[model samples]
Target: MRIDWDVPITMDDGVVLRADIFRPVEPGEYATIMSMGPYAKGLSFQEGYPGNWNRMIEAYPEIAEGTTNKYQNWELVDPEKWVPDGYVCVRIDSRGAGRSHGHLDPFSPRETKDFYECIEWAATQEWSNGRIGLLGISYYAINQWQVAGLRPPHLAAICVWEGSADYYREMSRHGGILCEFLGSWFQRQVVRVQHGTGERGPRSPVTGELAAGPETLSEEELAANRINPGQDILDRPLDGDYYRDRSPDFSKITVPLLSSGNWGGQGLHPRGNLEGYLAVPSEQKWLEMHGDTHFSPFYTDHGIALQKRFFGHFLRDEDTGWTQQPPVELQVRHPGEKFVQRSENEWPLRRTRWTKYYLDPDGQALGTTPSSGADLSYETTGDGLTFLTPPLTDELEITGPVAAHLTLSSDTTDADVFLALRVFDPDGEEVTFIGSNDPSVPVGLGWLRASHRKLDTQRSLPHRPWHSHDEIWPLEPGVPVELDVEIWPTCIVVPAGYRIGLTVRGRDYENEGVMLPGAMYPMKGTGPFLHGNAQDRPAAIFGGVNTLHFTGGVAPYLLLPVIPG
Candidate 1:
């Protein structure tokens, strides 16, 4: 294989972006696989994320089977593996984050335009067959949706592996609540390797060049060059241009697409994949859901083969058995770390029995009958409430989006509600899974800030409440109002005698489970996807007691997508 280091490609605005290209030695116009992101293209996977890297390698030793794994980068296709398969792999560091020189504004229209221009450039390259396929995980995958919407002429297909498409709903804010992950992530990942870090940042082993940039700028200058997404998100409380600019218009994403999500990737990954598959106007689209650590599965043999098959069919017109692939593929989660692969024609499965388990506030139980009990109140700073179902009489499968309808009131003007769907064995032990980030994640999670409860009826599905975060309607203290909370989709199969539990809290969910040895963060139920920002949930406004009211001409229920055989 041939490797080109730091190939300069000038954008329309005259910013020269740097890309590393890997192609076959005897290449004669091959289809191109490209990724453009803030993550330094030159930074190796093992160096950028040592914790995840070591864990993935230990779990799947075969990931290092073939050619030297030296070229592998985080959330990107391994050029060593793909180049031999007759494809050119190109990785470009988006302007301002890596070796590229420019102002740093992630997910901005400027960056997307740069991606589109890069696609056109890659297609025209001598190693390209004029067909470009976008493939990556997380940040790399997120931009695929953005550029695809622009409908770049040379773009042929997209494989969005665990990417968040809705910047507001999935990433920055969840159910209109600020998620601290965005801010913390910027500081830990992006800013650390940002342009101008130079001598402070590590060098790429392959090229022996600074992974950031060549010049080291003063701290003040570096701060001035980029926008702080955390502060920006907090400044724009209401979703508008700020968030929309980062999100994708699914209707305009007409390319053949494979939107892959993780069942345990709460907070971000799941919603976008499901929404993209359901909303995209593309005639050929597929959705695949799985379970595991965020980056592990993508590099596994299973993931690489699936990606190659899709890109193979769309970019090179190869069969690769992709023509016979199902529109929706799911790795149904069973207790004890087992996943059963299943293929289906559509999401929410046509045979889904939409089950409504009414909430009995007094008894703290979920039953078939509506509650006739009194209102339940809990301190906003404490565990709100938990409603559980009786042990199941038979095996049950829940494989789609989940929702909750509740009547709530607070002594203050607003309330932030955090909901977690969990399962417990007859012995009373909680059944958790290895989430994308969190090690002990619940079955599903949902959040809603009472103020931003207005729904976009046109976009709201019975099992999914589409919040219109365009405006905020603060609550009237002591007045009960109904709220529809949309839970990120999940897939779980519970055996007989197991029980389902829904815990409503005022803060991020916590599981006192033992943290895995190499886990990045504490194995709390929510992982690093936290939302306890003091400014967002200030003491004065959201510190009062919150009430869950029912039985007085009011009913609260959990809407579950139960798939039956």
Candidate 2:
């Protein structure tokens, strides 16, 4: 392999960005796989993120197979895999991070422009063919959506692995609840690799120089140059131009895409992949969903095989038979921590049997129809309400997005509803699994601050309801309002003698079993909020005496996308 370091590409703004390219030793002409992001390029995976490296290697030994693991970095494609295949694998440190010059802020318009110019630059290089493709995980993947919309002339295709599309809806907030990940992530990861302080950052193994630029600026200059897009999100807690500028207008992205989403990434990654797949105007597209650690499957043999096949067909015109592959491939999850491979023509399957399970006000049972014309109310401080189905006589599968329509009244001006879809065995023990955020988690979860329940009609789907969080409508005390709760998608099978359940609470879902090892991040001042916690839900903003009101007159019901047996 040949390593080319300190490769400079001058952007339109005259900012010189740095890149590290890994290519085959005897390369004449080859397709280029590129990734640009903030995380320092020189930082080793094991040194920067030991937990992720350990988990990835533990799950897929093949990742450590073949060439040396020297080129492996966090959340980007492995050069070892691509370099051996007669392809040039390039990693660029975005401005303000790594060895790049200028202010550091991710997904900004300036960064997008830099990415667009970088693609064209890679295309015109002496060792390069005009065709270029983008491949990476998380940051690298997320930005692809932005740059693709810009439609760089030399860009051919992209593999967006575990990236979210809507910056506001997916990354900054959950069910209209503000997220603290922006601040927390910036402090923990972004700030460390930010450009500045002359040569303090790690040096590229291949270059022997800093990753961002030749020499870093002073702290004052670095801060002035760096832009914190996350802080903008926190400033504007609603859908506005600030968020839209960072979001990809799928209609503008015409490039073929292989979008891979994680079934476990309920917080941000999965929603983006799904949204991009459905919304992007591209005629040639594919979707793949899997269950595993966030960073594991993306770099695994299975993931690499799929990515190469897709890119080969698009960039190399290899005709690798990828066109014959299924459009949608899902690793359907089972109850016993197993994934069942299934392929379908479309998402939310066309033949989805939509079943409505009504909320019984009397016994808090979830049934096919309403039990009586009586109101069921619960305190905001108490277990709001629960509805359950009888034990299944046979194995039943449910695999899609879920929704709930509630007629609720609050003692205060607003209410917060937290919905959890759960499974229970014959012993009545609740079944849980490892979620993207929390290890001990439930099947599906959703949340909504009652005032932000207004739906965006054009964007709402049968299986998923999109909210118009652009504005809030406070409630009148004791006045009933209709709320459509969007329970994030999931796949599960309830065995015979097992029951399916739904819990409508005023707050987040708490693990009923043994607690996992981690500091608890909860809602309000109460227990940990597994779905949307306190960092995102300040009491002054969400604190209210919430109420779950139900009756036959109101017809509150939970919608289940059940896969008929």
Candidate 3:
């Protein structure tokens, strides 16, 4: 293997971005897998994301079975692993990051253009055969959608591993509430290593060189050289031109794609992968969903083999049997924490029996029969209400998007509703799964701001209703308003004795149950996907009494996509 460090790739505007290319020593032309992102290309996985690295190696020992993992970058393929497999792996420091020259900006129209240029530039390189595939997780995967929208000729395929496609819905705002992640993440992770931060940032352990840049810049200059992404997100609370420009136009992404998502990543990961697979005009596309730490499964033997097969058929034109692969692969989850791998022709399998479990105020239990016209109210600032199903009489499989219909009133002008689809074991203990960032998370989650209840009827369906965040109508203080809250998809197989549970909360969902030990980082309620930003939901406004009214005419129910056995 030969690695060309700091290889220069000049963009259309003549600004050169630095890349590290790893290709076979005797390489002729080979299909290339590329990743470009803000997380410095030279930063080691162990240093940039220690918790993920440690969890990854522990769960998938085979990831480091042979190679030294010396070239491992966050959410990217190990060059040593892929280069030896007869493919070239390229990592580039995107403009404004690492050694690249430009103002530090992320997910902007400019960044997408830069990515397209990089793909074309690599196609013409000595170690390339004109075919290029984008690969990586989150940041790396997010840009793949953006660049593919440009329809670059050489962009042959893409493996989007747990990435968000909608910059507004999936990332910045969940339902219509503001998520604090994008803001907090920028301040902590990207600011210091931004382009001009230079020598002020950490040095590379491998090359013993400055990770940001070769030349240092003054504090004032460094601050001015980068965009304040978080603040910009805060300023634009509504989903409009700002997010649309950063998001992908799926109609134009026709390249073959392998989109993978995690069931636990409610705030961002799941929505994008599913939407990308279904919306993109790509004729050759596959969707796979798994349950585990975000980065863990990507490096597992299972992940590598799947990736190789997809790229093999598309990039190398090899008969790797990827052509016959099912359109959707799911890891059917079980309460005791087990996975049953199943393949099907499409997402929301045609055989899915959409079941509605009606809310009965008495005992706060779930049943099919309409409830006695009972009214239930919980303080908007409290734990809210919980409804449970009797232990299943038989094994039940709920395996698609979950939605809720509630008729409610708020004492104030608006209310926030949180829905948690959870499972409980035979021992009566809550069942939790590994999330993108949250280790202890319930099976499924949904959130909706009462005022943002306006639905797009043309795009609306019983299974999933698209909410047009274009308008907001506050609740007539104390008047009943019906809402359709669409919970992100989840897959779970409940045993005969276990039970399914629903918790309606005024705030983010949190498992008051025992937490995992030795957690590297603090993951609060709803994990990092929280949306309790004060600017969006001020206590003065939303902190009021909330009510759930149940009756035959206005029954509140949980609609689950149940796949029959």
lDDT values for all models: 0.90, 0.79, 0.86
Q: Write the per-residue lDDT of candidate 1 for residues 101-180, one digit (tens) a residue.
A: 99999999999999999999999988899999999999999999999999999999999999989899899999999998
lDDT of 2 by residue, 1-565 (tens): 8988768889888888888898988848799999999888877776677765775687688888895888789888878888888789888989878777777778888899999999999998888888999998888899999999999999999999988888877777677676667666775677777877447666656446665445667777777876665566657757888788988989999999999987667667777898889889899999998876668787778888998999899888998889898989989887767888989999877777999888776767878976655676665556767788888889988888889888888877777888888899899988776555555667877878788888999989767999988897988888889999888777887788998889877766666544433333432211222334554455654455655556535577888888876
Clashing residue pairs, candidate 1?
A: none
Candidate 3 residue pairs in backbone clash: none
lDDT of 3 by residue, 337-385 (tens): 5888999998889999998998889999988776766699998788889
- RMSD over all Cα atoms, model 3: 1.6
Q: What are the models' TM-scores?
A: 0.98, 0.92, 0.97
Model 1 vs. true fold: TM: 0.98
Among the numbered candidates, top TM-score falls to 1
Candidate 1 has its poorest 10 consecutive residues by lDDT at 513-522
Q: Model 3: runs farther than 4 Å from truth? A: 513-521
- How many clashes in each candidate? 0, 12, 0
- Ranked by lDDT, the better of candidates 1 and 2 is 1
lDDT of 1 at 377: 91
Report the lDDT of model 2 for residue 195: 72
- CA shift at 16, candidate 2, in angstroms? 1.2
Question: Best candidate, lDDT-wise?
Answer: 1
